[model samples]
Target: MTTAIVPDPEAIRPELAQPGSALPVPPQGLRASRNAGFTSLRVGVTALWLSVIVLLPLAAIAWQAAGGGWQAFWLAVTSHAAVQSFQVTLSISVVVTILDVVFGLATAWVLVRDNFIGKGLIDAVIDLPFALPTIVTSLVMLALYGKNSPVHIHLQHTPPGVGMALAFVTLPLVVRAVQPVLLEIDRDVEEAAASLGASGPKVFATIVLPSLGPSLFTGAGLAFSRCVAEFGSVVTIGGAVPGKTEVSSQWIRSLIENDDRTGAAAMSIVLLSISFAVLVLLRIVGGRAAKREEKAA
Candidate 1:
């Protein structure tokens, strides 16, 4: 038999001769470290952007709010006009959100699953709210519905007019949110349900609604927040009627006009807190729904 020669283990690779051979690291480890560094860089950039854009402004508001102490903050947020403004804002937001959800879903479904003439025009028009300045939107509404117009419904200086303006502004949010989710749904699943004798409503209820729940809620929360903070349109259309049509944003503006900066900041904080709470609640509900859908799948 020929003698078999075994090459020394460390002869081929010099790294293997060291006491802590593994410490030298492999090519894969180098790539992993590079990827980790890139990820860290991305995270740092995002944090910096958020701090400058969102966190800093919020901190400034909070600090201003706290400058007057708890008693002043509490009084500012709870005064009679403030309370009425909050009520008006919440009520209109609720109405606008409901209408937006209903019409937005229908519009998204039509845009996604249907074909028609003028479809492109309609799709472009849906984004008009986003493209138009909010003040311009109020002007448009005023022109169309003011007392002098042919189709005048006299909506100016009313809660209904404010709601209308807000709904128009927020319409695109829900439609855009639900549209992508609708596009991602598999058509064959709906067909299969139909072949199994499921009615249209049954298929939609069982197959479509659950998948859309999270996105719909997310869009509603966004719309609600927008409605709450709506300033130009609400102020123009509603005219800041103290006990009747005044909303939170109008109230804040009035406070600022009166040179009550601390009160304005306090009221802003209250509005921000409410919006944050509602958004958090929606997120929790959406997460649970998403988890349930995953489990079912």
Candidate 2:
């Protein structure tokens, strides 16, 4: 029938009046205000710097591309050389991406999971493409596969010319992208899969492949874009033969050589557009895959 008695309001002291916090209160007024202003200034300067260096170029390119009216843009995209170049670039990029995915995964897995006598040397060699000039890779491929080359004597004639060069440059991209992700993966998961009834292929397909999908996709997209814009390497090795080996970049070079600046710019716009489109599509797919994984987890 009786209620509990309530404590007095005046019993609470000033120290106990405020909400609990781990950090002590700072001296207020000018000092705190100046500190906040300095922090804001630093953030603003960093953002401004990045925008100038990175976003400005992108904005310039976009402005140039859109300078041509919609009709001109449409005409540029529909031209025979432009269409052919698009097809060729896309085809080669796809081919190289697939090759890089297979070989890149293998190389990343070996570098991350396996430790052999020449492991460090092998890892260093994988990054050779990053340091070596693209022209060098092109020359090497030409020397390896061209008609005058001794290595080509047995094969006689194989269209592996352009593909070989593109793959060489893209190999480092895929390997580097996947290597970090592979290194981050827990070895225990792989070991557990092995301990189960899973065989080598089974473990890789079910366990490793799923985890590597995002990095593999990012690497593939990067490789594809690189192949699409590739100039020095493919041009030296493949020779821009229209209806055959003429990639977008090579086609642009040829156009410029023929003193066709407008057409070259137009074609360059096409290449940039396709690259942006593909990149967007890939990012969307990667996002969906990430969400699905989150739900599954």
lDDT of 1 at 225: 95
lDDT tens readout by residue for model 1, 1-297 = 999999997977777786856545568988999999999999999999999999999999999999999999999999999999999999999999999999999999999999999999999999998888999988888887667767858888888888899999999999999999999999999999999999999999999998898899989999999999998776577778877789998899889999999999999998899899988998899878878978989
**What are the lDDT scores of the predictions, listed in order?**
0.91, 0.80
Tens-digit per-residue lDDT, 14-69, candidate 2: 44454653334555786789899999999999999999997887677556555766
Best by TM-score: 1
Root-mean-square deviation (CA) per prediction:
5.5, 8.5
TM-score of 1: 0.86
Model 2 collision count: 0
In model 1, state the lDDT of residue 32. Answer: 95
In terms of lDDT, model 2 sits at: 0.80
What's the TM-score of every candidate structure?
A: 0.86, 0.79
Instruction: Give the worst 10-residue stretch by lDDT in candidate 2.
Output: 151-160
